[model samples]
Target: MKGYFQKKKMIEEIDKRIIRELQGDIPLEKSPFAVIAGRIGISEEELLKRAKSYLDKGYMRKFGAILLHREAGFKANGMGVWDVPAGDVQRVGEIMASFSEVSHCYERPSFADWPYNLFTMIHSESEDGCHEIAERISRATGIKRYKLLFSTKEFKKTSMEYF
Candidate 1:
Protein backbone atom coordinates (compact mmCIF):
# COMPACT_ATOMS: atom_id res chain seq x y z
CA MET A 1 0.00 0.00 0.00
CA LYS A 2 3.06 2.29 -0.21
CA GLY A 3 1.81 3.59 -3.58
CA TYR A 4 -1.41 4.68 -1.86
CA PHE A 5 0.50 7.42 -0.05
CA GLN A 6 2.82 8.30 -2.97
CA LYS A 7 0.22 9.38 -5.58
CA LYS A 8 2.23 7.54 -8.25
CA LYS A 9 0.91 5.79 -11.34
CA MET A 10 -0.90 2.51 -10.86
CA ILE A 11 1.55 -0.37 -10.86
CA GLU A 12 0.68 -3.97 -11.73
CA GLU A 13 -0.05 -5.00 -8.11
CA ILE A 14 -2.41 -2.08 -7.39
CA ASP A 15 -4.01 -2.39 -10.78
CA LYS A 16 -4.62 -6.09 -10.15
CA ARG A 17 -6.11 -5.38 -6.74
CA ILE A 18 -8.44 -2.77 -8.21
CA ILE A 19 -9.44 -5.20 -10.94
CA ARG A 20 -10.19 -7.86 -8.35
CA GLU A 21 -12.55 -5.55 -6.46
CA LEU A 22 -14.25 -4.50 -9.71
CA GLN A 23 -14.64 -8.07 -10.97
CA GLY A 24 -16.90 -8.89 -8.05
CA ASP A 25 -20.35 -7.40 -7.76
CA ILE A 26 -20.15 -4.25 -5.66
CA PRO A 27 -21.88 -4.40 -2.27
CA LEU A 28 -25.52 -3.37 -2.14
CA GLU A 29 -26.00 -0.39 0.21
CA LYS A 30 -27.35 3.10 0.42
CA SER A 31 -23.88 4.37 -0.40
CA PRO A 32 -22.33 1.77 -2.71
CA PHE A 33 -19.29 3.95 -3.35
CA ALA A 34 -18.61 4.06 0.40
CA VAL A 35 -18.84 0.27 0.61
CA ILE A 36 -16.40 -0.14 -2.28
CA ALA A 37 -14.06 2.54 -0.94
CA GLY A 38 -13.98 0.97 2.53
CA ARG A 39 -13.16 -2.45 1.08
CA ILE A 40 -10.40 -1.00 -1.14
CA GLY A 41 -8.93 1.11 1.70
CA ILE A 42 -9.38 4.32 -0.30
CA SER A 43 -11.53 7.42 -0.16
CA GLU A 44 -14.84 7.35 -2.05
CA GLU A 45 -13.75 10.31 -4.17
CA GLU A 46 -10.56 8.53 -5.25
CA LEU A 47 -12.47 5.39 -6.20
CA LEU A 48 -15.01 7.45 -8.11
CA LYS A 49 -12.24 9.38 -9.86
CA ARG A 50 -10.54 6.12 -10.85
CA ALA A 51 -13.82 4.67 -12.13
CA LYS A 52 -14.65 7.87 -14.00
CA SER A 53 -11.19 7.85 -15.50
CA TYR A 54 -11.71 4.28 -16.65
CA LEU A 55 -15.06 5.25 -18.21
CA ASP A 56 -13.53 8.35 -19.83
CA LYS A 57 -10.66 6.26 -21.19
CA GLY A 58 -13.10 3.72 -22.71
CA TYR A 59 -11.86 0.94 -20.45
CA MET A 60 -15.48 0.70 -19.34
CA ARG A 61 -18.30 0.81 -21.84
CA LYS A 62 -21.68 2.05 -20.55
CA PHE A 63 -22.57 1.45 -16.90
CA GLY A 64 -26.32 1.26 -16.57
CA ALA A 65 -29.32 -0.94 -15.83
CA ILE A 66 -30.25 -3.87 -18.10
CA LEU A 67 -33.93 -4.44 -17.58
CA LEU A 68 -35.86 -7.43 -18.87
CA HIS A 69 -37.73 -6.37 -21.98
CA ARG A 70 -40.79 -8.38 -20.91
CA GLU A 71 -41.02 -6.93 -17.39
CA ALA A 72 -40.73 -3.41 -18.77
CA GLY A 73 -44.10 -3.86 -20.54
CA PHE A 74 -42.54 -4.34 -23.96
CA LYS A 75 -44.83 -6.94 -25.47
CA ALA A 76 -42.94 -7.39 -28.71
CA ASN A 77 -39.63 -6.38 -30.26
CA GLY A 78 -39.33 -7.12 -33.97
CA MET A 79 -36.20 -7.67 -36.02
CA GLY A 80 -37.15 -5.71 -39.14
CA VAL A 81 -35.02 -7.17 -41.89
CA TRP A 82 -34.62 -5.62 -45.35
CA ASP A 83 -33.22 -6.96 -48.60
CA VAL A 84 -32.04 -3.60 -49.90
CA PRO A 85 -30.00 -3.61 -53.09
CA ALA A 86 -26.26 -2.96 -52.71
CA GLY A 87 -26.61 0.56 -54.16
CA ASP A 88 -29.13 1.67 -51.50
CA VAL A 89 -27.91 -0.39 -48.52
CA GLN A 90 -25.89 2.41 -47.01
CA ARG A 91 -28.58 5.03 -47.57
CA VAL A 92 -31.37 2.84 -46.20
CA GLY A 93 -29.26 1.62 -43.29
CA GLU A 94 -28.46 5.21 -42.35
CA ILE A 95 -32.13 6.10 -42.54
CA MET A 96 -33.12 3.06 -40.45
CA ALA A 97 -30.41 3.92 -37.92
CA SER A 98 -31.93 7.34 -37.26
CA PHE A 99 -35.00 6.01 -35.42
CA SER A 100 -34.76 6.26 -31.62
CA GLU A 101 -36.96 3.16 -31.25
CA VAL A 102 -34.49 1.15 -33.32
CA SER A 103 -31.92 0.03 -30.80
CA HIS A 104 -29.58 -1.69 -33.28
CA CYS A 105 -29.18 -2.00 -37.05
CA TYR A 106 -26.74 -4.25 -38.86
CA GLU A 107 -26.00 -6.11 -42.08
CA ARG A 108 -26.17 -9.85 -41.85
CA PRO A 109 -25.27 -12.63 -44.29
CA SER A 110 -28.32 -13.51 -46.35
CA PHE A 111 -29.74 -17.02 -46.64
CA ALA A 112 -31.73 -18.71 -49.41
CA ASP A 113 -34.83 -19.07 -47.21
CA TRP A 114 -34.31 -15.68 -45.49
CA PRO A 115 -33.17 -13.27 -48.16
CA TYR A 116 -32.90 -10.24 -45.81
CA ASN A 117 -29.40 -8.74 -45.91
CA LEU A 118 -29.91 -5.83 -43.49
CA PHE A 119 -31.64 -5.91 -40.11
CA THR A 120 -32.97 -3.27 -37.73
CA MET A 121 -34.33 -3.89 -34.24
CA ILE A 122 -37.59 -2.15 -33.36
CA HIS A 123 -38.35 -2.26 -29.65
CA SER A 124 -41.65 -0.80 -28.53
CA GLU A 125 -44.01 -0.86 -25.58
CA SER A 126 -46.55 -2.87 -27.59
CA GLU A 127 -46.70 -5.26 -30.52
CA ASP A 128 -48.71 -2.77 -32.55
CA GLY A 129 -46.19 -0.04 -31.88
CA CYS A 130 -43.32 -2.24 -33.02
CA HIS A 131 -45.31 -3.21 -36.12
CA GLU A 132 -46.00 0.47 -36.83
CA ILE A 133 -42.31 1.26 -36.69
CA ALA A 134 -41.54 -1.68 -38.97
CA GLU A 135 -44.25 -0.65 -41.42
CA ARG A 136 -43.05 2.94 -41.38
CA ILE A 137 -39.53 1.82 -42.19
CA SER A 138 -40.84 -0.48 -44.93
CA ARG A 139 -42.87 2.35 -46.48
CA ALA A 140 -39.98 4.79 -46.12
CA THR A 141 -37.43 2.48 -47.68
CA GLY A 142 -39.78 1.15 -50.41
CA ILE A 143 -38.59 -2.36 -49.57
CA LYS A 144 -41.54 -4.78 -49.55
CA ARG A 145 -39.88 -8.13 -48.90
CA TYR A 146 -38.75 -7.56 -45.32
CA LYS A 147 -39.41 -9.85 -42.34
CA LEU A 148 -40.56 -8.92 -38.83
CA LEU A 149 -39.41 -11.51 -36.31
CA PHE A 150 -40.84 -10.67 -32.92
CA SER A 151 -39.73 -12.05 -29.58
CA THR A 152 -41.84 -15.18 -29.19
CA LYS A 153 -40.69 -15.99 -25.67
CA GLU A 154 -37.73 -14.89 -23.61
CA PHE A 155 -35.77 -18.04 -22.84
CA LYS A 156 -32.89 -16.13 -21.27
CA LYS A 157 -32.35 -12.55 -20.16
CA THR A 158 -29.94 -12.60 -17.28
CA SER A 159 -27.34 -10.07 -16.14
CA MET A 160 -23.92 -11.24 -15.08
CA GLU A 161 -21.04 -9.52 -13.26
CA TYR A 162 -17.66 -9.33 -15.02
CA PHE A 163 -14.70 -9.40 -12.73
Candidate 2:
Protein backbone atom coordinates (compact mmCIF):
# COMPACT_ATOMS: atom_id res chain seq x y z
CA MET A 1 0.00 0.00 0.00
CA LYS A 2 2.86 2.40 0.92
CA GLY A 3 4.67 1.51 -2.33
CA TYR A 4 1.53 2.31 -4.37
CA PHE A 5 1.16 5.72 -2.68
CA GLN A 6 4.80 6.56 -3.38
CA LYS A 7 4.39 5.66 -7.08
CA LYS A 8 1.24 7.77 -7.28
CA LYS A 9 3.04 10.76 -5.74
CA MET A 10 5.85 10.45 -8.27
CA ILE A 11 3.37 10.29 -11.12
CA GLU A 12 1.62 13.42 -9.81
CA GLU A 13 4.96 15.24 -9.58
CA ILE A 14 5.80 14.36 -13.20
CA ASP A 15 2.38 15.56 -14.31
CA LYS A 16 2.94 18.84 -12.49
CA ARG A 17 6.29 19.24 -14.23
CA ILE A 18 4.69 18.56 -17.60
CA ILE A 19 2.00 21.16 -16.94
CA ARG A 20 4.63 23.68 -15.84
CA GLU A 21 6.63 23.10 -19.02
CA LEU A 22 3.53 23.43 -21.21
CA GLN A 23 2.31 26.62 -19.54
CA GLY A 24 5.11 28.65 -21.16
CA ASP A 25 5.77 29.49 -24.79
CA ILE A 26 6.47 26.51 -27.05
CA PRO A 27 9.76 26.41 -28.96
CA LEU A 28 9.49 27.55 -32.57
CA GLU A 29 11.62 24.78 -34.10
CA LYS A 30 11.39 21.80 -36.42
CA SER A 31 11.20 19.38 -33.48
CA PRO A 32 9.63 21.47 -30.70
CA PHE A 33 8.22 18.44 -28.89
CA ALA A 34 11.65 16.83 -28.96
CA VAL A 35 13.17 19.95 -27.42
CA ILE A 36 10.52 20.06 -24.70
CA ALA A 37 10.93 16.32 -24.00
CA GLY A 38 14.69 16.73 -23.71
CA ARG A 39 14.17 19.49 -21.12
CA ILE A 40 11.80 17.19 -19.19
CA GLY A 41 14.33 14.31 -19.41
CA ILE A 42 11.88 12.13 -21.37
CA SER A 43 11.87 10.78 -24.93
CA GLU A 44 9.75 12.59 -27.54
CA GLU A 45 7.52 9.52 -27.88
CA GLU A 46 7.00 9.29 -24.11
CA LEU A 47 6.13 13.02 -23.94
CA LEU A 48 3.54 12.60 -26.70
CA LYS A 49 2.10 9.51 -25.02
CA ARG A 50 1.76 11.30 -21.69
CA ALA A 51 0.21 14.32 -23.38
CA LYS A 52 -2.30 12.06 -25.12
CA SER A 53 -3.05 10.36 -21.84
CA TYR A 54 -3.63 13.76 -20.22
CA LEU A 55 -6.22 14.58 -22.88
CA ASP A 56 -7.85 11.13 -22.74
CA LYS A 57 -8.13 11.28 -18.95
CA GLY A 58 -9.60 14.84 -19.07
CA TYR A 59 -6.59 16.18 -17.20
CA MET A 60 -6.14 18.75 -19.96
CA ARG A 61 -9.07 20.29 -21.78
CA LYS A 62 -7.19 21.51 -24.85
CA PHE A 63 -3.74 22.31 -26.21
CA GLY A 64 -3.90 25.17 -28.70
CA ALA A 65 -1.77 28.05 -29.90
CA ILE A 66 -2.39 31.62 -28.75
CA LEU A 67 -1.83 33.85 -31.73
CA LEU A 68 -0.26 37.21 -31.03
CA HIS A 69 -2.69 39.32 -33.06
CA ARG A 70 -0.54 42.44 -32.92
CA GLU A 71 2.41 40.56 -34.41
CA ALA A 72 0.03 39.07 -37.00
CA GLY A 73 -1.10 42.57 -38.10
CA PHE A 74 -4.46 42.41 -36.31
CA LYS A 75 -3.95 45.73 -34.53
CA ALA A 76 -7.51 46.61 -33.60
CA ASN A 77 -9.71 44.63 -31.24
CA GLY A 78 -13.23 45.40 -29.99
CA MET A 79 -15.18 43.95 -27.15
CA GLY A 80 -18.62 43.51 -28.70
CA VAL A 81 -21.16 43.42 -25.93
CA TRP A 82 -24.72 42.38 -26.68
CA ASP A 83 -27.91 42.64 -24.67
CA VAL A 84 -28.96 39.12 -25.51
CA PRO A 85 -32.02 37.56 -23.95
CA ALA A 86 -31.28 34.90 -21.32
CA GLY A 87 -33.07 32.22 -23.34
CA ASP A 88 -31.25 33.10 -26.60
CA VAL A 89 -27.71 33.62 -25.25
CA GLN A 90 -26.37 30.16 -26.16
CA ARG A 91 -27.67 30.25 -29.76
CA VAL A 92 -26.58 33.86 -30.30
CA GLY A 93 -23.14 33.23 -28.75
CA GLU A 94 -22.63 30.31 -31.13
CA ILE A 95 -23.48 32.52 -34.09
CA MET A 96 -21.11 35.25 -32.91
CA ALA A 97 -18.33 32.70 -32.30
CA SER A 98 -18.69 31.34 -35.85
CA PHE A 99 -17.10 34.46 -37.33
CA SER A 100 -13.39 34.25 -38.11
CA GLU A 101 -12.96 37.80 -36.82
CA VAL A 102 -14.13 36.74 -33.39
CA SER A 103 -11.44 35.19 -31.15
CA HIS A 104 -13.33 34.95 -27.86
CA CYS A 105 -17.06 34.76 -27.03
CA TYR A 106 -18.78 34.10 -23.76
CA GLU A 107 -21.74 35.07 -21.62
CA ARG A 108 -21.28 37.09 -18.49
CA PRO A 109 -23.55 38.22 -15.69
CA SER A 110 -25.45 41.42 -16.42
CA PHE A 111 -25.70 44.31 -13.98
CA ALA A 112 -28.72 46.57 -13.59
CA ASP A 113 -26.83 49.53 -15.03
CA TRP A 114 -25.04 47.41 -17.66
CA PRO A 115 -27.45 45.01 -19.27
CA TYR A 116 -25.11 43.57 -21.94
CA ASN A 117 -24.71 39.89 -21.08
CA LEU A 118 -22.96 38.36 -24.06
CA PHE A 119 -19.48 39.50 -25.05
CA THR A 120 -17.17 38.75 -27.97
CA MET A 121 -13.62 39.77 -28.80
CA ILE A 122 -13.38 40.76 -32.46
CA HIS A 123 -10.02 41.48 -34.06
CA SER A 124 -9.11 43.23 -37.30
CA GLU A 125 -6.49 45.39 -38.97
CA SER A 126 -8.30 48.60 -38.05
CA GLU A 127 -10.91 49.92 -35.60
CA ASP A 128 -13.39 50.32 -38.46
CA GLY A 129 -12.91 46.68 -39.36
CA CYS A 130 -13.70 45.67 -35.81
CA HIS A 131 -16.88 47.75 -35.94
CA GLU A 132 -17.76 46.09 -39.25
CA ILE A 133 -17.22 42.66 -37.73
CA ALA A 134 -19.46 43.63 -34.81
CA GLU A 135 -22.08 44.79 -37.32
CA ARG A 136 -21.93 41.42 -39.09
CA ILE A 137 -22.29 39.57 -35.79
CA SER A 138 -25.28 41.76 -34.90
CA ARG A 139 -26.86 41.02 -38.27
CA ALA A 140 -26.30 37.25 -37.90
CA THR A 141 -27.53 37.13 -34.30
CA GLY A 142 -30.34 39.66 -34.95
CA ILE A 143 -29.33 41.38 -31.73
CA LYS A 144 -29.19 45.04 -32.63
CA ARG A 145 -28.69 46.41 -29.12
CA TYR A 146 -24.94 46.11 -28.90
CA LYS A 147 -21.81 48.17 -28.42
CA LEU A 148 -18.13 47.82 -29.39
CA LEU A 149 -15.67 48.83 -26.66
CA PHE A 150 -12.27 49.29 -28.23
CA SER A 151 -9.17 48.91 -26.11
CA THR A 152 -7.30 52.14 -25.56
CA LYS A 153 -4.19 50.28 -24.41
CA GLU A 154 -3.08 46.81 -23.45
CA PHE A 155 -1.13 46.59 -20.18
CA LYS A 156 -0.47 42.89 -20.27
CA LYS A 157 -1.56 39.75 -22.06
CA THR A 158 -0.39 36.32 -20.94
CA SER A 159 -1.74 32.82 -20.42
CA MET A 160 -2.46 31.50 -16.91
CA GLU A 161 -0.03 29.09 -15.27
CA TYR A 162 -1.78 26.43 -13.20
CA PHE A 163 1.26 24.46 -12.11
lDDT of 1 by residue, 54-146 (tens): 678665665555567778887678988888887888889988999888989998888778788999989998888988898888888788888
Clashes of each: 1, 0
TM-score versus the correct structure, for each prediction:
0.72, 0.83
- Candidate 2, residues 1-163, lDDT tens digits: the string is 3543256665577777888898787899999989999999989998899889878866677887878888999999999899999999889989988998888999999999999999899999999999888888888889999999999998998788876
Q: After best superposition, candidate 2 residue 71: deviation in angstroms?
A: 1.9
Give per-residue lDDT, candidate 2, residue 34.
95
Error of 1 at 124 (Å): 1.8
- Lowest-scoring 10 consecutive residues by lDDT in candidate 2? 1-10
Cα misplacement distance, residue 20 of candidate 2 (Å): 0.8
